[model samples]
Target: MDRTTHTPTTDQSRPLPHVVVVGGGIAGLAAAARLRGVVGGGARARVTVLEASPRFGGKLMSGEVGGVGVDLGAESVLARRPEAITLAQAVGLADALQPPTTAKASIWTRGALRPMPTGHLMGVPGDLDALAASGVVSPEGLARAAEDATLPRTEVGADVAVGEYVAARLGREIVDRLVEPLLGGVYAGHADAISLAAAVPQLLAIAQRERSVIEGVHAALATAAQNPNPAPVFTGIDGGIGRLPGAVADACRAAGAELRTDTPVASLRRTAESWTVTTEGGEELAADAVVLAVPATVAARLLAELAPGAAAELGGIEYAGMALVTLAYHRAELGPLPGSGFLAPPVDGRAIKASTFSSNKWGWLDKAAPESFVLRTSLGRQAEEAVLDLDDAELVARSRADLREAAGITATPYATAVTRWHAGLPQYPVGHPERVARVESALAALPGLALCGAAYHGVGIPACIADGWRAATAVTAGEVSPDLVSGTK
Candidate 1:
């Protein structure tokens, strides 16, 4: 029952390193695959992926409902990032990618679904006049946003909450009205708790470097527009995000990396030279290098005995629960699927935070069919935790009511599907970067040990892939990358 797949081009008579990845999620898989590629087919280290669940991908899951595809976990990837796109091409799955169908999105505020302002990057509006014309925010809020140039520069470290920084620079109206909703949609976190440094370093750097957010935004936009071939605005597979995990898994297997499902890890301990891993079934494994690519909480528990200080700090990071409810209805039932989808402001007092017209978000989907429209609605954030507690029937009813008010849908849907994630999304609280730095610095002292996953840098798919690749590079050479170890350029 020894599950090890490795071939060393280096002198086999000499000692060869064995790597054990404690998590079958994408982070672990990416780390394993990248290490093999860098080390070459035969010289690559023996790699084993230990997963607690029956399958890989961690938070990424997809399934077909009534012959229609649905993504139960992460839905899309940002095209501007090089990690995901590069990984896709390297793994032989680049042909499956597609861009976001439209740049426009709807906002449910002040009454009904209205077109969101043009040139608005998340909550930071590029054109004040365009934002004022969108009717999403009040005139007073718009006026205040235009005055961000006068806001004084802040000396806060690279570990402050997004709410504290944005509200101080822009105004409470902007944060509560737009920034909070956008962050909640992405991280399912509270703005008051999410770290600007950890969750959005780009935004923080802009404010810190330029001393004026408006000028920074304009400069960045101009630079982006000048690129000969800019990346896609957004990306998703033709079928769903599930394709990504499958592709990564296939690549790992092709690279001769051992993969096991339904084999949950029981415990892990670090020794002077290597790690001793125990499985739930009492199996034991010894590896020269170890990668813990999972949630901070899971990694904390696994490394409690090895790195006590780091584990203690990691265990403090909190996560939130979320639910996705997809409703299918005839176009006549919901009326014309106007625009993209709508995001609900925190002040709206609604059960759902956002709803996307899935059928319209991608061209790969069959739009010529006379079938019903598919609307994917998300519920449960700090503003409304009770929504996650709702039963299937209740969730469907609540979604229907919200759609009726927001999208002018009156007729009932032909079908409804629901998926729930319990404490799935990690919340990077204020001072998160400093805490992560402490943990990483301590871990650097341990030989051939690397940590990767959404719990550290970012929650996006691209970020997770980049983290895994970085971790693999660090552990393969028995040294930590200065950029990754320091966590800042």
Candidate 2:
């Protein structure tokens, strides 16, 4: 059940299927859109998306901050992944695709801000000299990290924690100051708990091949440098990355799909030749296939009766809550912004984990607010939910204080906005690969039933889109046995 190894087989002769996608997030929308494309015209598959919330997009949201349009949720997608970019282009967002203006980023640690070390992958330094020159790691820490080459190879059985593995090879300073913040920004989970095999599978594979972690990183970086047409690492829509979901939803609807918001799914049951998906309002919809694309907790609740094993594994997955405090100030108040903003590692004892200079990073935002300096700071992480308890005003104040301490800016913001995401990010802990395998295996028994989202494959937009596409392909290909559809398996 290796997620990387399994591939879905397709059958074009299968009878037209009816797909019911639960949850209206990017994953669900992507599934519906792809399903339509696969089935084509002439009363193929009838696709329906049911969203519990009033809005279709899950974390992709847009709002006005200080009279300027801005993203309140996810703002960018990694351009390296073709899924998101391909989907965007397919949905007519090709003209809107924009790359960040700045690539520089700094790390705030050990009492000062310093440029992030070059030749590193997720904080694992490929060039030791570059890391030492950056001054992010102390002399003692640098010396300890240099010893990695001489030390015996550490055995990584099955899976290992990202921090534990890196710290063992390098030093604790690298884990605390470098890896922690970068990894936190994505998973919102502590490095000591995140699974290296699941979070960074490439690194895990390299670790298994090379004796030295440094050598492994160096080899990977070298390979990346050889790419002829290297694309930008990240990209965003002209308006905002939040616009992606709406565009995808539109495409889904255009393909003859019915989308319903404020309709939470209450239960799921299997019947002869079809599956019954009951809504919270007591309405039932029968479908040939069902895709559970909601949060892991919600999916678990709905699948408990149909797939108890998958439900148990889904229930075990944890999530992290986070809040973003976006503040806008006059350009005159903050003369110039440095880098794209800085990441404050937890070891720095700062309330804010990271800050992105929206005005400096994206040319569109700068042009939209020529007189304003807009930036957003993120707070809270896995097991660090105390900041979420504070009121929006208090959170803004704390964010301002942290910004001032980090970048000597004291001017009061002309406008401020706070967006709270409760249990937004999924945590991938050690042995997550095995957990995913178990979940997939259990679902395999219940044909026409699939799951996809940040909780599975990956948390990035591209990964989610790929997950959705795969699920749609699997369900529509008549891969599900008729016996399973009739609850006989």
Candidate 3:
């Protein structure tokens, strides 16, 4: 089924090798745009994107709510990830980027929202005095955390669950009360499943090198403090996260990459020098190289026969479902919200795992007269499947109850938008590094094929762009380097 090369009849001039990018999500689009620019210039290489959905963006979706743009999926990029920033610059949307209005965050505990202690990075504290003064943890809990400097260190491979590692280094209380809930909100995953190396490697690096989580954090913070320039916390676009995908798509079109929507890929098979990609409508596409940029599960099905080993490894990767319920209400309608956001411990039997004061947290978005508030409540986590079983009405009701009890918000929201992401967030399970190594090793055996997505490395928007661009770069270069693609493994 694999053809050495493909030259469509409509195409003029010498038809060069083609690069077919599967899935129209950001990863796919990024790869297509990059490859078209670098390899065929769109006209020569014949880059065609085969998306399985009517629209692009995958998880980066935005829509108007009460005449305001609301992002329904993957939200902001941190300034720390420079790859996304560079991609934005390339797409001509660098000017649209903006930092989070405020870096302030909080935790929902004891039916109240309290500010996260300063100098704390993902539950690892650099300032012990601040941790003690923040009132987030008990005195005994604070003492236990400080004692991490004296506790014996555990040496293990890079593949380990974040929850287990954090608990071992710090304590179970911190893992459950702070790290699990706070970081867990990012993936909507169980701490026990998310890999420490793949998900939060910085922490692992701290433990491995410094021998103490606190000492490592302090050293890192000192390095940051010494830097000539330091970046902010949360990074986003001025308009919204939606601007990123839109800008990327525009750049792809300008680069001569053809984008087709309302199309779904049926299957794929590898040829001697190219791949034959079939669409749901029975049309077949030919390409010299292909990039599978969708979810791991989708990639597994597409590469089942052509790359069975990689497909099997990809299929083994797990994902968690997520639902975002955005509720807007007048400031006076709710008594008062004291924190930017709240992360619920797993012990809390409530359906909501986290909630953010969207409008207040971002100064520019707080345009409502009299200070109207927008709250984004999240439901479902890796270990909490029952939350998703609740019907929409029941889900909203439960969320409202949690907010009312936690933040004293009794007023009904004027606008409510609920989005459910099934198998939305990728979970970097233990031994993920080995699994990725296996998949990438298998992919390397194929000279031109590559796979890119949040399923591999960091799930942030920037990481996906980095993976996509790298894959495209390899195709254009006609050869791929292991270090470039196999970053960790």
Q: How accurate locally, in lDDT, is each candidate?
A: 0.77, 0.86, 0.74
Number of the top candidate by lDDT?
2
TM-score (C-alpha, index-matched) for candidate 3: 0.91
**Which ranges in model 1 have alpha carbons more than 4 Å from their true place?**
8-10, 14-16, 38-43, 331-334, 367-370, 382-386, 478-489
Ranking by TM-score: 2, 1, 3
TM-score of 2: 0.93
Over 147-242, each residue of candidate 3 has an lDDT whose tens digit, in order, gives 787887778675678888877776777777787787787777877877778777877787677777887788887887877777876777765677
TM-score quality measure for candidate 1: 0.93
lDDT at position 481, candidate 1: 37
Scored against the true structure, residue 487 in model 2 reaches a CA lDDT of 16
Candidate 2 steric clashes: 0
Position 240, candidate 1: lDDT: 79
lDDT of 2 by residue, 165-270 (tens): 9999998999999999999999988999999988988888877888899988998999999999999999999989989999989887776688889999899999
TM-score per model over all chains:
0.93, 0.93, 0.91
User: In terms of lDDT, which candidate is stronger, 2 or 3?
Assistant: 2
Which residue window of length 10 is worst by lDDT in model 1? 480-489
